[model samples]
Target: MDHIVIGTAGHVDHGKTTLIKVMTGIETDTTVEEKTRGLSINLGFAYMDLPSGKRAGIVDVPGHEKFIKNMMAGLSGIHLILLVIDAGEGVMPQTKEHIDILQMLGIKKYIIVLTKVNTVDEELVELVVEDIQEQLEGTLLEEAPIYKVDSLSGTGINELISKIDEESQKIERSNSLVSPRMHIDRVFSVKGFGTIVTGTLIEGTLHVNDELIIFPKELRTKIRNIQVHEKNVNEASAGMRVALNLANVHVNDLSRGDTLASSGSVQKTWMIDVKAALLPHAENPINLWDRLRLYIGTREVLCRAVPIGVERLEPGEEAFLQLRLEEEIAAKKGDKYILRSYSPMHVIGGGVILDTLPTKHRRFNEHTIETLKTREKGSTSELIADFMNRKEDLLTSMEETASYLGMPQTEVIEYMGEMVKKNQLIKVHQLYMSSLKYEKLKKDITAILDRYHKSFRLRTGITKEELRSRVASNVKSKDFDKLLQLLADEKVIKNHETISLSEFTVTYNKYQLKDKEDIEQKLKKAGFTPPSELELIGDNKERKELIDSLTGKTIVRLDSETVMFKDYYEEAVQKVINFIKQNGKMTLAEFRDMTGSSRKYSMIILECLDKNKITKRVENFRLLY
Candidate 1:
């Protein structure tokens, strides 16, 4: 069953409160001031069982002009609107303003309820209905079903309730796959319960004992209890009006507009990029640096609107804007917001947020404008690609990217997997890069290797550190290791202790080859006690380079003073293993006698065996490693 929150909107004293009472049999105006003044001052909530057995939450908003902000606060989670118009007064000023707000905030459905039909004659009632129908032209409510009822007499009330039930089924259920987030509109402390917050569960599910973070302040807390329509439940689903009992928190620490969400999901921002437009009858154009009142998700903030790609946004003109906020807010992409004049708060315009986390963009930046347009209109996959392409060479992680896109990490990974197959994205180990960036990086690596090979023909490869510093220094160590190994697997590069192009090899002139062969023969002839490196180098620098290149491949450099040919080194390793296997251990004297070498040579060779893990030294002997 779809959990729906329906909100009441219209002029003051339009019978909104009494209508809710007639529908739900519950008095919504519970505050003493409201009872005394006979007007709603803040939000009032009630629920009723519809014919379909779906419990529809009813939010009663203050219709007075002074409390319009309070009205906006409760309407954030509403799926439908009860646009109340007085039968005697027809369409009032606040009714018009409320309709504008509803349209701007993206309320998809509304049922026009004309109250106090008993007080008006049949002709007057028909005239009022016709006037409202004419007034609703060019709006989402133009074709809305209008019902005339008298709350005091309970006339036509059942028909309105049935219509509401029918419309409630039309509401698109909130997605439970997204991370849960709720903007706290009320926070108070009960005597036994620590901190209790009331709001609509906007998306996902909140379970008892689930860890939560309040954004904009980021106060950490846990859910101790969950309630929907005042009944405790193990979990609350999206679109339900929720009252959360929060543990380890205080009423003073939280306030209205603080978002309760899973940690690292919803972001806090002091700036946002949006596609803003003005109401058709707006009084003034939006000028640059115009301080405006921004109402988003129950939070009212002071912000400066810097128009993009235009100097001033006239009435009914659409433009991109970067709203520089005075206070931080927890917002996500596609959240609709209302804009009001800074001093006297009246709805001037509103638009949907395009980017919650955006840099301060200068006016008239074509690229920035293009990006905003795409983000506002593009599909989800396009949005991901656009965001990734903007990152240049940086490898994006799933958590951060999902947070920015306002999606679950698992869901983003699914989209990313498809993109990878389409060659639109590249998965480099655990990180993500745009295919454009990946191709550039691949080309850069190949060019660097080409230059290195040409610059130093005798060198086999470049150190891994040098390659990383040139390719992308910010790449994590483990990611870089995986990247190099991947390149080697693709046959684009060869990775060992160092990295090189797959086709790269050390080359030597005929004279240098003679010196390399001469060094190899000397080491082979001096098998038991190979000549030292310096002895082999003698006076030739090129001989030293050739000998150094042969170290780990054809020669095992035992120490600075001792070296051995690869074959002799293998023979000595086998001898130590054979002796240890038969005699259990071998001493330096035994090896010296066995090989007919001196004590110095024997000690060096034994120590070399220990270094190579061919043998382990006991007290005066060696054992097989």
Candidate 2:
């Protein structure tokens, strides 16, 4: 069955809650203060059965300007809005505010309800309708049906119900039957039921015995029972006013603005990107870096509003804004938000959440502005994919990515897992590296190696850590190692201990052979006290040519500190082995005595031999193995 949420919006005493009570026979306002004051101060929810056997949830929001925050909480996830106007008062201040807020929130469908018809004459009602018709010009309600109703006398109430029923039949059925979410606008305890929280189910299905997590608090509990429209239901789904009888929670632990979701599905995010607007009657113009109260899906948080593409956003203007919140919030892509000024609070404007978790955006940059604009125009999936593609580093996990994208982690993970199964992307741990990235990494490493050989010929290759640090520092340490291992597995690169290269051995062309011979002759003639690679290649192409030719060859060994010629190294090793054979163990001075070389050279060659598994070096002696 198709389920639709219809919410009422207008000024206080406009009969929003009373109209709902009369239509659905369910009083939404359960608060003592609301009933005593004869005004709703929080969100009140009720549901009615349509003529077509469909069900529609009704959210009766507090219409007083002081409780506008409550109205914002009620408006989220609503498919249809009922903008209630008092026929006797014509158009009031909050009536206009509510209308502007609904427009900014992107409510496309609504039916305007003119209440208190019994208190006014037909001529006055016509004038009120004319004024409303003029005000709703160019808005969502431009052509919507307007109903005149008096809830007190039961006049036009039945007609309003029939209109809602007709509209409910036209509402499209949702395909999503995943885990359920109910943004709690009301929470209280009943005598028999432990802690019952009520709200319109925004998504998924909830049944008895289902585990749920209540957010910002993150409390986990099972559904002891379920009630929809004051009656017991085996299962509740999206667009139903549900009261969940939580198994193990207290009323104090529960509050308004908390969300009930299937366990381990929703995530918290401190940063988000949105496309917000200023309300028409905002007290002040919003400047760059101004702070505002962000009301989204029953949660109100203080967020720093960074105006994108402009230095200031005037009233009634729309712009992309980045909301840097003080606390983490549970929000999904396509969720509507209502923004109010921080001081002398008033509803300014609200828009959709584009990216749930965004890095701080650059101020007023055209490219960044254009990107955010594109994200604003993109679909939920497209925005998610674009967010992933724009990241310089791999997303650490699908869960994190989904949070970053303001999408349900399950939805993104399912789609991403399918893509991986299709070989479009690769996963290492929770990080996703695109197949294109893997291929690019392969090509880049090969190019780096090829360039390295051209620049310094005396080095065998580069260390894995060095290459990783230089090529992409953002790659996670473990994933970098994993990528190197994957490269080795694919034979894209060869790993010799920590040293890695595209090719295992260096090739010897005629030019390289000549260069190697020249360096060898220079080292041998100098009696193994050869010049450093930099010294030989000092500011001259000839020297560079020589070092490049002998890289990775037996002729020159690039050790930790110094370079040793193959012949010199062999002579030194043979002298050490001979001394060890003659003396069983030779002291360092004795080995120095055998090589007749400098202390540094002898020590370096000894360490090189030790590293090569040919000899063991101790405090004062060497042992041939």
C-alpha TM-scores of all predictions: 0.84, 0.69
Clashing pairs in 1: none
**Model 2's TM-score against the true structure:** 0.69
Candidate 2 per-residue lDDT, tens place, 1-625, comes to: 5668898988889888888888888987897888899999877777777877777888888988998888888876788888888999877889888887888777778898999999988998998899989987987789989999999999988888888888777666542444567788888898976788888787777889988788867888899889876689898777667788898899999888888886545657888878877766677888877888888888889988778777888887887878888988876666788888788787778888877657787877787887787787866545545656656675456755654454556778887887788766777776887777677778888888778767655556776777887777888778888888888888777776444465656556686677667677777775545566676555666656456435445455547335656777777777777777888897766766666766766666677788888888676777886
lDDT of 1 by residue, 493-536 (tens): 98986678999888788998889889899988888877777889
Cand. 1 TM to true fold: 0.84
Best by lDDT: 1
Per-model root-mean-square deviation over C-alphas = 4.7, 10.0
lDDT of 2 at 603: 69
Extract clashing residue pairs from model 2.
Answer: 278-348, 279-348, 279-349, 457-548
List candidate 1 stretches off by more than 4 Å.
Answer: 391-393, 397-415, 429-431, 443-478, 489-492, 502-552, 555-625
- lDDT of every predicted structure (CA atoms): 0.87, 0.76
Scored by Cα lDDT, where does model 1 land?
0.87
